[model samples]
Target: MKAMEWYFPKSREELAELLKEEGALIHAGGTAIKEERIKSAKRVIDISSLPLNYVKKDGNIWHIGATATLNRVIDSLESDHFLVKALKCTATTPLRNRITMGGSVYLSPLWSNLMGPLLALEAEIEVLGRRQGTCKYEELLSDRGKFQGCAVTEVRFPDVKLIGWFDRFARTSTDYSALTVTIALSVEGESIRDAKVVVTGSKKVYDRLSGVEKALQGSRLEDVDVEGISRNVNVEFTDKPAGSGAYLAEVSKVLLCRGLNALGSAR
Candidate 1:
């Protein structure tokens, strides 16, 4: 077996220089750095000491640094925040303490509880290195190859007040979710002004249900057909130990309707 080389860069400039090295991978919380995943990598750059572990609200945007752990981010938000709801259901308390926000977003695994909510929130990811600016989360997922040498610096999202709902399906509470659904809506009076819907653990890893969102937009919350819209959600799932692809698709529809109804009743 080839020995692994590790580099600890305490500053952004130092981290940038290390990123230029061939076959180098960033190690923040180290939760996602499995041996099989890094078998071809000969170098690991540890950026835990960098000044990137922060959570702050600036004006109408919430900024979370790359190295901030899941628990830290959850603590920074309101008890009812969508992110807190989703993140609390992620892994376990011990694991959440070790899973960093950047690592989860950077390598959005099939079971990730973060991606669906982030997509629903239309969050922007800030990176340093090859890509040194903020880009929509969907854009990053679509063209991840272009960010090979990049280091995710921060994730920021609008602080708008939206009714949020999150749900995950797993045999056990601590197990990876077979399917996850997230919904956010802006309601005025009895009408829905805007809506965002997202699902994870699908064949595409994650998907934004634009069709569903469009159907909910400008509709009276009480009149919206949640069940009908959920049944029409176009998504493909891959078979997993928890359930078959067909089974998951059906399950997703049920969860979507339940989540939407829950949000609708919240208003």
Candidate 2:
């Protein structure tokens, strides 16, 4: 086996220069680095020492630094905050302490519990290389290959008031999720002004249920047919150790309806 080369960059400029190296991979919390694909990389850049571990709110926007651990971010949010609800469903406490917000967004594995909520919130990520500006979370997911040289610096989203609910299905509490559902609704008076539905652990990694969102828009929360809307939506899944594709699809629909119902009850 070949020895791996490691780099510890002390500054953003230093990190950018190191990222220019061929096959260079960023290591924040080092949890995802255990993956076979990431383990094979010959060069690793650790960015934990940088001043990126922060969680703060400025006016109406919330900013979370890239190196901030999952627990750290949760500590800064209310118990009912969407991010707090979704992140609490991730790995065990020990692993959650080692999972960084930036790393989760960058890797976006099939079982990631972060991506679904981030997508539903329309979060934006700031990068430090190649694509140096801020880009919507969805854009980064769609064109990830184009930003290989970029290092995720921060994640920011508006502090919009919405009724949020998140749920994940797994055989065990510590097992990877077979399906994760996230729902956020903006309610005005007695109607839903807007809605965002996202599902993770699907064949496509994660997806936004635009059809369901459209159906919920401007509809009275009390009149929503959660079961019908959930059953009619199409979401493909791949067979995994957790469950068969068909089984997971069925589970996802059930969870979706449950999430919608939870949101409606919260209103």
Candidate 3:
């Protein structure tokens, strides 16, 4: 590995200016950066001092600062059960203490424990730099180039009244998941008025199961066959240590059914 220069930016403006240089990368928690080699980056711009660590609730939206560690998010957002579950699933207590939400959102690695839940909640990200603006989480992940000279400033999630559940398949609780599933639904009486299902490690980084959502929407919870509905959901996978693509697809389907069933059947 080559020696890399590091710079600490005290403000977003300074961070943006530093990013203007070629071969520059933003260092949030430094968790992911430590794991991989940024061959193209000669300088690392640290944004931790920019004061992005925070969690605030405003009416219907929850604002999470980019540098907020996973543990901080767990303690700060008390009402988001799914968020709590997902954060707890990530690494161990020590790692969670260092892993920042912005780093995870930007990395979106295969071992991600947060992406699935964030997608299910329909979270939006606020970035600073060339493409400085709020964009859907999926959109940002889809074209990471948009975040090229940028740093994630915050993540926003709606504080809606909905049933949500999250589950991940792994050899052990601490092991990275092969696949993760999250479900959020709005149930009116016994019928589902709206539904959202997100799965990670499915052929793509994130997949929204539209087929499953359409099938469950407007359906009476008790009458819906959760397992049968899950069969209609299709999830592909890339070749990874977890299992073969076929095996992962099957596991994703089973877990999706279980998560959706738990959310739908919840009283």
Candidate 4:
């Protein structure tokens, strides 16, 4: 094997040019890429100098630069926000400080803690390269090819008030979760207007519980059948650190029930 080449692109235009080369991978925090085999790439494009590190609120939107670290996100959002809860539950302080939001979102790692919350929150991202435009969180995740040769500039999240919940099941606090769940409920008075249940660290990578959401819609908190609705969620998992697919699914239901109960209690 030959030595890998490296380029530092200070601007998006330069970054695009560098990305045109085959086997050229963007380096944000490099946490995910570093762990993978170097044979996967021939060149590395460092984007640290790019102006992509920021966290600002623009009216009803929250703009987070791609290079913003998990720690940065936690600091930017309110303590009660589901995003903050997810980030805080991800890893230990040191690792959390090193993991970049862009890297997390772009890679969409199987053990990702960011995906569930971001998906549930309906976040969008700015991409520059082969795809130079904004894409919905679901679209980007479902079709990763759209992200190839692209640099994720930033992630945009809506500024909305809602009751949220997040849960993760791992052997230890630092261990990769066997399963992760995030729920964001828009409760208008006594009725549940909107509900989103997103789960990751499963065979499907991540999924939104539409069936459960529909069941909860228009239903009062006290009328919710947390156990039955949770059981309806069908999640599959490959060989995971925690347990078998069946075991994880069972655990997921338990977590779902707990999360829903917690959300109801908040009201």
Best by TM-score: 1
lDDT of 1 by residue, 1-267 (tens): 889898988888888888777778888888887788688788989898899999999999999999999999999999998889999988888988999999888887756688888988889998888667889988888888988888888999999989898999998887889989988999887888899988888898788889999999999887889878976787899888888999999889999989878776766
Residue by residue across 184-231, what tens digits does model 4's lDDT show?
888888999999998888777887889998999999987798988876
The global Cα lDDT (0 to 1) of model 3 is 0.83
After TM-score superposition, the amount by which residue 171's alpha carbon in candidate 1 deviates from its true location, in angstroms, is 2.1
How well is each residue in 1-267 modelled by candidate 2, as lDDT tens digits? 998898888898998888777778788888876678576899988998899999999999999999999999899988888789778877778988989989888877745588888888899999987668889989888888978888899999999988888899898887888889889889999999999999888888787899999999999998899888987888999998888999889898998888888777766
Q: Rank the candidates by TM-score, best first.
A: 1, 4, 2, 3
- Best of the two (1, 4) by TM-score: 1
C-alpha-based local distance difference test score of model 2? 0.87
What TM-score number comes out for model 3?
Answer: 0.92
RMSD to truth, every model: 1.8, 2.0, 2.2, 1.9
Clash numbers, per candidate: 0, 0, 1, 0
Stretches of candidate 1 off by over 4 Å are: 1-4, 36-41
Estimate candidate 4's RMSD in Å. 1.9
lDDT of each: 0.87, 0.87, 0.83, 0.84
Q: In model 1, which range of ten residues has the least summed lDDT?
A: 107-116
